[model samples]
Target: MTHFGIICPPVTGHLNPMIALGYELKQRGHSVSLLGWEQHREMVEATGIHFVPILSPRQAPQPDQKITSSRRMRLRHKLHRLKQRLQPVDHQAYTQSNGISALRIALAAYQHWSAIALRAAPAVIKAKGIDVLLVSETSYGGSTVAEYMGIPFITICVGIPRHQSSAVPPYMTSWPYQLALWARIRNRLTYAWLDILQRRILRLLNRYRRDWNLVPYTTLTDSASPLASLACLPKAFDFPVSLPHNFYFTGPYINDICRKPVTFPFDQLSDKPLIYASTGTLSNQASVYRCIAAACDGLDIQLVISLGGKGRDVALSNLPGNPLVVDYAPQIELLKRASLVITHAGLNTILESLAQGVPMVAIPGVLDQPGAAARLERSGAGKFIALKQLNAKRLRKLIQEVLQDPTYKDQARQAQAVIQQSGGVKHAAAIIEDVLDLAHISV
Candidate 1:
């Protein structure tokens, strides 16, 4: 039997797609193992895959931030990361977030996590007899591991920028045309800096890689210069501008919805249009959730809101007569029934919402969320609101606009129809198998 090994960041945005891939493999009789933090054990276990826990030297990472959502600030974000790398701080205590400060924090964690893997991963690889290594696009040291093991590696593209860092070529892709020429030049310089940074990081990783007594990989194979990458998202939502072969656009790999399904309160609004408000797994902004809830109050349409992370305690109690207030709700189920989705613009959530043909009210909080929201607006599927201006009154107006404009739903439905027919998770699994087959052939 073939074995697949996965390493991913702890966040659900990273972990969930990996889990879906693992489950897909398990159903086909392949043994799967996951490497992650303890908090994600249950998520991996739920997929029926063997889970292996890994630890960093310390918790509470300082911050590794990058700007991914907006092309306007992405170069600036990279410059910020470069400055952090040049300046040495505690480094061990930062979470990998999307801002400059956050990126500074993650750089240390990325190195620390890889350093630990240097000793531990080889043992696991030998023990599992892994055939292929599917590393996260944003995962710290996974690309290096695949090289160290001499195994086939495939990176999953959950979003743009960081997720595309290891796989997509920097030179080939450029910022949107609307960006000023100076900004584009700056973005190019930032990309060059990142390219240098990635090379240095890989050099450090390769030292341990050689120590593992494994055959080393060439720079190109290990993402030395990225161009065109693969993803499971649908082409209708995201089309490849440059590298068509690089992306395996398998559509959104929604986690299997068969777990006895949680029943949300959407059944109450059979007549009025239904809207779902969610902030996704990370950056669960209470302010956004409360604002959405408050705006939704007294509306005739049914409202289901998800306030994830830490807790789902949405304090917007005593709603205006009609809106249903729930701390947590079945998002997938809600999206299927929803006419509109109020969201933080996460790729997974945004794609799922679009796949279901539900228009969006994108409230960009941090990171690629704003980009996802912008995509929605550009595609005519939704509107984007910066977190600073998000409020009930604004949301109420947006929802009304979405309802009045048939084109929004029509646009969303177009994307949904395309994604639904684009082969979703099953197709993604098939692509992975092909990559594995190619790996075996090469070996």
Candidate 2:
């Protein structure tokens, strides 16, 4: 059986698609294993895949409480609780610094995380006997490891496509796909500026690769996967563009492969239309949650807000009306019953909403979200509102417009049908097998 090593950061969005693909591979008689944070060992192992821990000190600790009567035990418990509370703030400060912009912070975070992943990958790859490696595009280290070991690798674009193309605007912006002459020139210039900004990071990575006697990459992302890659979203969501022959959209992996079932107040539902709002697991800001909650206050609807794991400090008691506030919820299950969704324009959430035929009001926070939101609006499946302009009144108006209008739901269903036909996990498996076959023929 062919063995595959699934390498990615321990974020929920990144891990879900990889795990779904792994399940498809395993069912075809191939073996699959995941390499990620030590804290996620139990959760990953429970999925019946081999879990390889990175053992990095920077990895966040999972919440666990132990009771002990002794003074020493009590002291340790107190310290642990203190650490847990401070972690969110520390992480926020690191991600949102005054001197550095969010983009630079993301690059720095990626660089640091890749360094940790690189240190642990070689031994894991050797031990697992992985023939081909599948890496989420965001996991920069996986690509580095594959290059270092001279192994054929496949890159998975888990979010909006990040490939540099002149046909569409650059990612992480509110710009629409269709641009005038000046705008098109401006888009290319923006890309050029980004390349310049990332030159130092690219140089550092190339230098790191030289230590292992590997060729330098032109850009940080350009040389990550030289063989084949998978785009996890449906083809309909992307603007028209030419791609490499090896690059293909394998549809969204919408299966419940790697998700844990969450309990929500399902029985307490009223006849009013249900609105599910979330800013994804990582970008769940308390202010955004408060705005969404307040907007739906006194309205004839059930509003459910997922705080993600980062909103521990947000107090739910002071919320307006009887809005349901939970740390996490069963998103897919909720979407099935939801008439509308208010999201951060995260690709995962957007795809999920579309797949379930639920219209959305996207409020993109950062990263590729803004680009994805713009696409959503263009597709007629949803609309986007700027974070600065978002308020109780504006959000209420948008929600009413989307719900009262039938075009949004119709377009969402159209996207849903395309997703279904794109041949999700089954198509992805066939692509990987073809790549393997090609390798064998070359050998």
Please report the candidate that would top TM-score against the real structure.
2
List, residue by residue over 237-281, the lDDT tens digit for candidate 1.
Answer: 542344535556778777753222455565565666778777763
Best by lDDT, which number?
2
TM-scores, one per candidate = 0.76, 0.88
Off by over 4 Å in 2: 57-90, 94-100, 281-284, 441-443
Off by over 4 Å in 1: 55-99, 102-116, 161-183, 189-229, 244-246, 257-271, 281-284, 312-323, 439-443
Question: Per-residue CA lDDT of candidate 2, range 316-387, in tens?
Answer: 567776688788888888899999999988898999999899999998766787888998998999898977
C-alpha lDDT (0 to 100) for residue 286 of candidate 1: 50
The CA lDDT of each predicted structure is 0.62, 0.75
